[model samples]
Target: MRLNLQTDYALRTLMMLATHGGQLAVDDIADAYGISRHHLMKVAGRLAELGYVVARRGRGGGLSLARPAEEINVGSVVRDIETLDGFVECFDAGSNGCPVAGVCGLQGALSLAVGDFLARLDRYALTDLIPSRQLFAERLAPTSPSTSPP
Candidate 1:
């Protein structure tokens, strides 16, 4: 049940944005998270495409969440970034090489596990991660100049 690095980065970037509640540059996010801008750019592009975030250009432009933190569901974010959730080769739709694939209890158990994972995420919103908006605002204020809008 390991998420890909892309999905990990996407979540991290989203959390940072949620905490900041302001426009954030790709480079700043990369630096803060100690990730590559190249990698973050791909994640950012996907986020923007999915309407999770908005990208702006020019001197006063950067990126910000398309909707408020409270409006975005954590489960939706995970589902959007995940390409596949197969825990075993037989679980994959395109390749079920296992001879007992159709009757295996393992597949059902794994499916339940995945469902539980998503269900837990469904209980949370992006705002749930921040806990305190004032604390996040204070933390971002110091890094504001580097990651600020524009």
Candidate 2:
């Protein structure tokens, strides 16, 4: 059950906001993860639309978690941001082309596996991902030229 890049970026953005506990510019998040600002922007937009994050535009504008970190369930976030329909061909009943779709036990097994995967994630929250906020912040902090390796 692999999450697409969009879902990956969405989770990363949420985790950063959860750790920062304050509004952060999209560019800052992108720079921290060495990801494309454009791609992050799209993910941020989707997150904002989903009511996970508050996006403010204009000067001093930034993104911030819409609710408390502990209230944001990891599974819920993934379900909201991820398109699981394409996980397996049979998962999408309308587009399923498998000849043995009805008789194949693999689809049912895969379904259970995906359910278990999400169930495990349901046990965690955004805050759980950042066990040490201080350490996370420190790691994400920009490095000065003096601290940069040759």
Candidate 3:
């Protein structure tokens, strides 16, 4: 199963925040990942709304994780950010237009698969994704000497 760009960005953003363990600007994240700042902003906004992140505006303000890295579950984050209903065309009854909608076993199998996928992800936390925090921080902010792992 493939994750949509929004979910991918959300996971990456969490990883970055966990690695830094400090406030990070949306622009900085965008620059590091070579992603769109606007897209990251929307992701960050959603993360803030969901209580996974804390966003502060104005000078000396930026984005930071609301809780410690170990407290943030990867599966929880994905579930919060993803629309699992659309994993397969037949998963959504109201909008499904597939010809074999009810007669096929694909939908049921896929549903179980999705559940297993999430269950496996539940075993990991944000900290688990970055085994070497210092290395990640260095690679993420190559030229920025001020950035370091906490």
Candidate 4:
């Protein structure tokens, strides 16, 4: 199952924050990932609302992870951030027009696949995904806003 652009951007934003481990502006994250600012702003806002990232507004203020990387589970993030529904045509009865919706094993199999995928994701955290804090720190540049923080 392909994750939506929002989910992808959310993950990218989280990973970038994890790497920098410092205050980063939304623009910095968008530029770092080469994603749209409008979309990233939504992702960052949702992340802050969800307590994944702490957002501050003032001088020298920006965004940073609310907790340590090791504490933030990747799977939980995906599950919480993603709109997990309609893996297949038969998954949603409202839009499902499949003739064999009830009997077809495809839906059940795909469900299992999605479950397995999520389960595996739950086993990993931001730290686990990074593998090396040193490498991340070295690669990620710290964000320095020229003007007062928004």
lDDT of 3 by residue, 1-150 (tens): 788889999999999989887999998899989899999999999999999999999898889999999999999999999999898789888989999888989999999999999999999999999999988887877455565545
lDDT of 2 by residue, 63-123 (tens): 9999999999999999998877678899998999999999979988988888998999999
lDDT score at residue 142, model 2, on the 0-100 scale: 88
Expressed as tens digits, the lDDT of each residue in 1-150 for candidate 1 is 688888898888888898887899988888877789998999999999999999998788878999998999988998999865556786687977888888879888888888899999999998897788777656545455777668
Better of 1 and 3 by lDDT: 3
Q: TM-scores of the models, in the given order?
A: 0.85, 0.96, 0.92, 0.85
Candidate 4 lDDT tens digits, 15-96: 8888887889888787766679999888888999899999987777778999998899988898878877766778788999
lDDT of each: 0.84, 0.93, 0.92, 0.84
Clashing pairs in 4: none
Cα misplacement distance, residue 111 of candidate 4 (Å)? 0.3
lDDT of 2 at 98: 94
Model 3, TM vs. native: 0.92
How much lDDT does candidate 1 score? 0.84
